[model samples]
Target: MVQTFLPHPPGARLALEDATRARTGSPVQMGLDELGTPLSQTTFVVVDLETTGGSPTSSEITEIGAVKVRGGEVLGEFQTLVDPGSPVPPMITVLTGITDAMLVGAPRIGEVLPAFLEFAQLGAGTVLVAHNAPFDVGFLRAAADRMSLPWPRVQVVDTVKLARRVVTRDEAPNNKLGTLAALFGATVTPDHRALHDARATVDVLHALLARMGPLGVTHLEDLVTASDPVPHQRRRKSHLAEHLPGGPGVYQFLGPRREVLYVGTAVDIRRRVRSYFTAAEKRRRIGEMVDLAEEVRAVPCTTALEASVRELRLIAEHDPPYNRRSRRPERRPWVRLTDEAFPRLTIVRQVTPDDDAIGPFSSRRAAEECVEAIQEAFALRRCTPRLPRLARAGASACVLAEIGRCGAPCTGAQDVPSYAVVAGAVRACLREDAEPVVAAVHARIATLAVQERFEEAAVQRDRLRSFLVAARRTQRLRPLWRCPELVAARRAADGGWELVLARYGRLAGTCLVPRGVDPMPAVEALVATGEVVAAPTTAMGAASSEETELLADWIEDPATRLVRWDESDTPLACPVRGAARHAVPARG
Candidate 1:
């Protein structure tokens, strides 16, 4: 039989009880203020179980007890004993006072599970609460699976986890159910009986709920995640996320003076921004950023890809203090062929339309390493001074000529045509073909290893790897940069079409077509209204290399379909494969 009680007398309301009741409506509301159902209106089914063993696999449920309550009022209760299909262990019987003889006519788990599930009302927005939830829930889930009974998905709250967050060590020895029951002055004393223990847990649940108000946990969602306590300072700033839309977008945390402190992208802007003020955000730097943030601004987009591209662009534009990556696009180094009588590979901070370049390497050090690799593979001139088109009469070669590392065009020893051959090879390696350079470096590494010069071989291997990786990136990006415009579509996770228009390796526009709708109209509209990206004057393209790389990744996805391609002399393709096979040195 079900028992009932009212923990709070009529008209005796707690601090936030009235406010919580007024705001309690639909749990599906997306506003930060309306975060799930208010705790006052949430139905909590406090459950406890007596088991034959600790593990669900080896153990069986001996009894089940639960009390369903809402607004400090008991709605109902469930209590039942189960025959474990075997004699109870003496140790378990001694702990719970249930002996083998007591299970003679008790119903089996299959017969009792349906009634208990009905009492809990698990499918209709009711939450399941337990002291140590995993143990009790694990046993029930295992029993249901064994009987082939469908288990409804339900939100579970663990009082043990909640008490640890709310009740300090000074107030309670530990977060054990018995200790918490005593600390909260529970009316029912637990004596290992399922119904009695579940009764004690109801008082503990209400007492814990009363203490959570000052911690800014008024909603049922907040209470479930209360174990990860949010600082009072961060919790106060949660209102900043209230107005943000619940959609794919880019969000910027603005400082007191409205300066961007951090930029991020998320599929759900409201939920993701709200996480910054919670324990979900564990980065110390971001935590500090949140403390200083005065407002949050969102830029909604149609698809996740657009959000990602917008995030990269915003990061580059603001160079926010908290963002470390993709902040300074201008500072990225590139390895390019300098235009001169004898062109040499030089690391530059910028790339021009006339230049043939291979990078946008991560740093100047990496660019230098790539240049060293190219020099090791070819006889390109290393001299910094530009030589005359015709070799001068009094020119003298540097020590590099004696070592035969350079063609020595400065000494008039090597004519313009011979030097041109070397410069052309370097250009080809940078722009068109990387195999010759890769092969030359691989051969050098093999020869070094044969002579027991393993260290030198390893250095050659590293140099080649740097060059090949940069070459592969450049080869992949160049085609997209040269293409005037390309439109593509792919099936999204929601069974809809994701249409994108890219111009000169930059994301011009994106649109999402609903599942049952024809996407051709959306594709046409996207292309018509997209940004008009002009032909890039520089090899770096209209967008930053990082932005271009993001676009390239989307275009190269196997599931993406190319709807249209307006090529500019070069088709979209990577001519050379990666150098992973040749990157390792041969061991002696």
Candidate 2:
């Protein structure tokens, strides 16, 4: 049977239950009020344990002490000597001042653990406090495991972790229990015994609490989050994540009028969004975005990649104020193969219906660099603007012809039929075979090296690398765009497969296969229920380059596994001999 106790002054012993309460109607409700429970109202069980050794698995607890407090009043205290069922090492005996003889007739851990659990009120609204909690808790858990007893699910506060966040090195020499105990001027000094050390930790706890108040640490969650020290703006928006579900998904921060301010993905949305309100969130723009956020909305996805795709799509659609890359595909430059008799490689902001485009490159400068590399690699016509057949036949060859950079197509010197051979090589390079262009660039680099133009050769080498990187990126992604319909699956982080269906290169459906379950049913259900977003119908849709490029990017990730494609005759796979492998810097 458990004995009842009432709150009392510091160092006061537990009071006996009143006999008058037996005559009363019912047992008085002992719970504290729920609305914003103050630190004064919340009970703290400051705990300390003396163990035979550090490793809980190999060691055993020799003694345990805890002081229960509420509003700084001593509610109760528990102290016990435990029979560890093992020999105490000599060093442990010297350090803790505990010996095997003292525990000769003490209660075993099985009897001690349950009684201590009851005394500490191990349930909701109660928090466990310790100087170095992990050490004590580890032993407690080990004892519980040994007895086949369930450890209480209680919130634990490590004063050491808290002290590091709140106390500066200048204020305290170190965060050790003894140093902090003396620094805070506790009522009892810690002397290796359990109860005395617990009393000291209580004083340190109150000192840290006082320091935390000025720093806007009000709620328990705030107190816990203070350990990381996130941006100041994050604290003001802590309520934004109050209702977010903890799951894999995309989260959108919305401004006034429901305008999206930012879009992101997280394996655990609640934790990720709450992290923004902590000091650990260091992104400068995201901090500003959090300040502007009025509401947050979470959309759960089947897998991380699905969440990633959804985030990218939302970012593309809303062009959220804080998002930087992948926001405006229309503005991103593409490598355009002009539809002229003597076609020239050029970088354009948008792809036209008639143009044979190769990119939705990251930037205009990058696209220009790729065009330059391709021009160096192949003898494509270097003339700008459309070249008429008649004009090309009459025009004089430029000085570039003397350097062998071009086939002199502006003049009749190189006939259209003869020049088509080099043009065919350019076409093949753009379509898939990047080997010819890569080889040409290598040859040029070697020639420049032979001429002792090392700096120029380095520039050529960098250009070749840039060209190959872009070519490989586009090459990897191009097939996903070309396919009419596709089904693919990739292992989700949660030990399941994430299935995705695309129609005309746009995401049509997605679903998850729970662990240990067949995925085919979910895949069929998703395909049946999912909506096919119509592709852009303007010159944009005619290009089919941007959407396809995005799809290719998602598919290129090594984790993604393709299950099916619409064109069975044309399987979707990486090119056997593409520029991807050629771009690697050779080992010396």
Steric clash pairs (candidate 1): none
lDDT per residue for candidate 2 within 1-588, as digits (tens), equals 111111122355221122223323245442323113457777899999999888998888999999999888889999999999988899999998788899899999999999999898777878898989999999998888888989889989899988987788998989998999888888899998999999899999999988877665655666656666564456757767755656577888888777889998999887788778777678898888887888887776655556666677678878898988768867777776776677778887766433566666777776776787788777787778565565433477777888887777666667667777777777677767888767777898899999999888877777676677667766665555555667777776668777777765666666667677888777666666665445443223422344455566667679888776776534576677677667554312
Per-candidate TM-scores read: 0.84, 0.68
Q: Best by TM-score, which number?
A: 1
Candidate 1 lDDT by residue in tens digits, 374-465: 88878888878888877878888888788989878887788888888988888877877777778788789889999999889888877776
lDDT of each: 0.81, 0.73
lDDT of 2: 0.73
Best by lDDT: 1
Q: Candidate 1: where is the Cα deviation over 4 Å?
A: 1-34, 40-43, 53-59, 70-75, 85-95, 113-126, 141-155, 229-232, 235-239, 390-396, 448-458, 492-496, 514-524, 576-588
